[model samples]
Target: MSHVYQELNPGPFERKASMMITTNLSVLINDVLKGAATLLNQNWAITAAVNVFIIFFTVFLYLNTSTTSDQVTIRSASNNAFSGGNTTTLKEIVFHPNYGGLWKDDLALIKLATPANFSEGVKSISIAKSLPKQGTNAVVVGWGPKSYFSTTDGILREAVVPVMNYETCKQKYYPIFLFTDTSFCTAKDNVGPCPHDFGDPLVYKNKVIGIFSGSFDCGSTTYPAVYADVTQYNKWINKVIKS
Candidate 1:
């Protein structure tokens, strides 16, 4: 399989309008590739909702807010299978007001159509209040393919990746690409998320600090995997959940 990282154009990072798309993952990916960012304003919603038991491609980080029935979901387990877990429909989606272009503020809040009942297997995860220190070990969880050439195995997996310094990561993507302060990098290694791993969470000390955004080449040592730093958007998250 060929993994391509498309370069995004810099535009006004302002909240302009909102649009709704289907809940189909493949369709969403295609739209995103076709520059759906231009149509998606500050908040975008999906036509169909997702189950709370499994994570979908557009959501990550389940927040336990008492004000709303909608909760964020991450991409995990089989994308089309729900053999052993419960499922729920998504009610609404709220993307960051400043989200612009691909991998920039690549964060969103999913409101389930129905509230999820907390149980032993289903629970809310807290967002990171601060960024993790460089070299800290963080776990990336998803059901994406293990390698670029392999297909998705439908089994949820986790890999520990060390956080890379922003300066060091900046140098790696210098000239070709530039990451904003809202983003962070994980050291390049054989272990990292591949295609279909978008929206997966990167957790440090049980707090979600990152959301898998993009990678030049899956698991490429030359290019570290990038994530949207959740610490930079805690206030935005709270505001969305409460609104």
Candidate 2:
């Protein structure tokens, strides 16, 4: 909903139209559920089957929705941002063995003590198995500072960044640190990730393909921001998921 509002910058009539559509959809779904419930008393067998089917269907829908939102909110180890405090805890951080100098293999799988509750606002995001073709448009979201020297007020901002070809990125970043083939780049003059956006997911078509690594300098129009390619670490990610 927020994404639509921000991306479209909808007018009053458009907003009203959207609200009507949403309200109608909600009413239709509720009516269906209520009708299903009405079957409970008359036919126990049918009701049992209906209940089972609904459970499974809802689960599948949630998995897909949550998968596209894997990086919902960022929280500190201690829940200083909330009054009730977050129940989730970081269980482990698995970094690539070769992750060092120039932040190569700058990928890590964070395990939670308990899985996050997948609902209307919180969910998981799917990770991409294949790299995005060069020039693909990707969405970058973060709660980072607006600029290199600014401070974050905890507002989430998003940008559409275009993927750059490797040779071009390599040429631009040469002499600093050659980006491993396992890394990728994105940039547009004054339109890219900032310093505090490190570790944020870079999503393409609702799948996370890379993570913000670093840039020659934040907000650099000349130097594109680099990201650790998630496609190259699928095996490691799967291993961690299984573990």
After superposition on all CA atoms, how large is the RMSD of candidate 2?
Answer: 16.0
Per-model C-alpha RMSD: 13.1, 16.0
**Runs off by more than 4 Å, candidate 2:** 1-87
**Candidate 1 lDDT, tens digit per residue, 138-202?**
87655456567766534344566789866778788878664677788886456676765666567
Which number leads on TM-score? 1
- Quick one: best lDDT, which candidate? 1
Please give me the total number of clashing residue pairs in predicted model 1. Answer: 9
In the range 89-175, model 2's lDDT, one tens digit per residue, is 333445566765455676555444455443322334556888777888887655445566765433344567788766678778777
lDDT of 2 at 42: 11
Clashing pairs in 2: 66-124, 67-124, 67-125, 67-126, 70-124, 70-125
Instruction: Give stretches of model 1 more than 4 Å off.
Output: 1-82
